[model samples]
Target: MKEATEGRLRLTILGGFLGSGKTTWLRHHLHERAFGRVHVIVNEAAAAPVDDALLSAADRLTLLAGACVCCTGQSDFLRVLLGLCDDRSGLADPSMRVENIVLETSGLADPAAILAMIQAHPVLVRQIVVVETIVIVDALNARTQMEQEVLCRQQIEAADRLILTKTDLAAPKDLARLGATLRAIAPGATLSAARFGSPLGLKDPWSDDEPFALPEISEHDSSPINACQLDLGDTPDWTAFTVWLSALLYARGDQIVRVKGVVVTPAGRLLLQTVRRSVQSPEILPESATPVEGDNTIAVIGRGFSQDQLAASFNHFSA
Candidate 1:
């Protein structure tokens, strides 16, 4: 149990638009047997359970149907995660010492929303660290998808690594154009090309020392994206903040992609997160709070909201 509390669990989220080959890539990875003692969570299993079936040989894998982790299925996701914590001896699988977790989100899912939830869950923050966000882009259709689906653009924008899949099927000229477009959309992310299940010359991005880079929110109106950071200082009223957050999310669920923060409340340090309208229960921080210079800070990514709007809403939670 002590080891579970102290040990590190690295988490990697796989995201992409529909038909982007996320499952194929994951299936290949599993086949390679490179990921050791890792648990897998397949979201939106109802839409396509191929990934889940592919990993069914593993002793610790979960398939979540009828909901995406970013929204209706978040509570279930948290429960499954808590069960994976090695400290939960009663629930965790003794044969499998979980070292890493790979969450494959639905093609239509927004990775930002899932990332926010992971960052703001108390148990998760202490027991697991997100290593990277890998987004699969279909080289043949990425340009069209990016232009048509807001979720597609959001996925690309939030990725730490963008893997262009189906390259063999795409024309060389089209692939090149897609590459240029992705660079413009996700300038800070690492990009690579893959054909079939094999990543072409791409290296694994998760080493213990690798730095996690959160996605940057755009300030330009042309992008329909905005990122707001709120510094709530060292302490805040827990009840007030929760109330304000719930009301705000309820009112603007359609516009918000996600909200995640570490706040020092009067009760104790807590992790808070919301995806659209599903707000997860705040968990008490572990004995040691991850030091971040400032005690209480929150980051939000969304559309149709201005910084002023977010700040005003946050004002109600001010200590």
Candidate 2:
């Protein structure tokens, strides 16, 4: 971790179904001039590591797609993320100075589950807090997918920013209808749209006060399944204990659905995530160097577990 002065590496998670122009939305985040020293984690379910156009920079990018981000590769993601803070190899010259991390999950991934992984980590939750859960919806097939695929519906419902993309393919009336539907589903969020080839209207948020305050959730939206907090505190005895603990949880892989949290390891602060079953490496972050923005907090979600258990594990590592 770079020890950011403010304890902030404002993070944003981009979740959308397959080919919904997520990469397009991300390209805007990557090329913007103000987003200096940004890091990206790309997740895929295939073995072929496809290049991420959004992470256009050869050096600052880390791809984790092919990884069973929600299952098989959870630990691998954890190890690699912890390694990033320590590994000077592939990192940029300002290697230690890492700012925001943009996570690109698989088309079939579950955003909520992955978010829990990031919020549960003891270190990451403290440093790199999530600014928003932006779910990009495709105008064309979104309605059909939502109707037929429950996972698809969950993705849209769990988002803080509902981005409608691929508008070119949808009829004007259909697009308007879909947009209205999404607004109803997430009345609390700020809504917006972007076409694939067009420049996204979003400005570099780092230039201002921490990206708009976490979205205010309506009472009905207050459930843990969709709402989870990633808390970051002092580094954990992550050496062998954390590794063993991760393994124990991974062994029960099938039962674990989603995990997302910012974790602080002895090496550095990182973003941890799991979707479906595979996990993406915690995006290692440091605030010792960046300005401290706020207090540290981390939380994770599981299918049949208690938040107390999660809190207890993290408390065990308090400095």
Candidate 3:
């Protein structure tokens, strides 16, 4: 927790793999006001962003959708950072200036690349001081993810602090092994556990546990993950759609890493999310909240699937 330079703003980068609970943790921290008078910038790989709707607790929020900041959206990301710096400089009252910023990066992003981008920039390097890099790890699915995705391993290696989410769902023995594995990967990172969004004390009863052997992932090992959006027209059949989604996950869960969307149902505005084959209970959004522009459209993030294929499959099942 190094202090920011006298005039520079402090920035914290929050990154994690797909379905790793980054948003959940961020939402909670924002509600708790963990970062005083902070601004939040959320990046989504999908064109239709859903996570931004859930993070309403920030004092000021910016959405950078349709690209990951590490690569395709690098220019936009830099522009936003520079704009914030300019805005702060223009403020005559030092008390009115925003000194802290939290960047919740898209799951596909690499924090290391982003840090390098900032350090290499002439203006940003002087205006912003990155205080920390916190990455969330999915306790339940990280074993499979780490073995399959090189990006996942890169995220862990770049973390200054690692927060293991879904700790309640994972067995104690498995949790110990995963903890050991993460330590092996990022020895310098401080590790802790959380359930849903609340911090939990992690007790490693199995002190003698061995780390899981992670195999080398080659360029040819898997298909690149992409975010594809599916439009559920104004009038969607909730019952039929549920069935189609369940069947899709059952058949292709391995390829479909994450699914998230907001939909207006008879019950209310429902926020839906799924990770692999596990479907979280749908949460109803506040009735007073403003409507999301992309309601009824879901973003499917994973490999081995296209938008057309998803649309056709839903149509066939619903028909």
Please give the RMSD to the true structure for each candidate, in Å.
Answer: 16.8, 16.9, 1.6
Clashing pairs in 1: none
Mark the 10 consecutive residues where model 1 has the least summed lDDT.
205-214
lDDT of 1 by residue, 95-199 (tens): 556677899897657888887897798767887777789999877666655554567889988999999876776766566666666767787898887776687
Model 3: per-residue lDDT, tens digit, 102-218?
999999999999999999999999999999999999999999999999999999999999999988899888999998899889988899888778898878622557999999897
Candidate 1's TM-score reads 0.58
Off by over 4 Å in 3: 1-4, 288-291
Top candidate when judged by TM-score against the true structure? 3
Ranking by TM-score: 3, 1, 2
Can you tell me which runs of candidate 1 are displaced by over 4 Å? Answer: 1-6, 45-48, 57-59, 86-95, 201-319
Which ten contiguous residues of candidate 3 have the minimum total lDDT? 200-209
What's the CA error at residue 287 for candidate 1, in Å?
Answer: 50
- Candidate 2: misplaced stretches above 4 Å? 1-6, 85-96, 197-319
Q: Per-residue alpha-carbon lDDT of model 2 for 99-168, expressed as tens digits? A: 6666777665677876677678776566556777888887776775565456667788789877776566
Residue 294 lDDT (model 1): 32
User: Against the true structure, candidate 2 has what lDDT?
Assistant: 0.57
- Steric collisions counted per model: 0, 69, 0
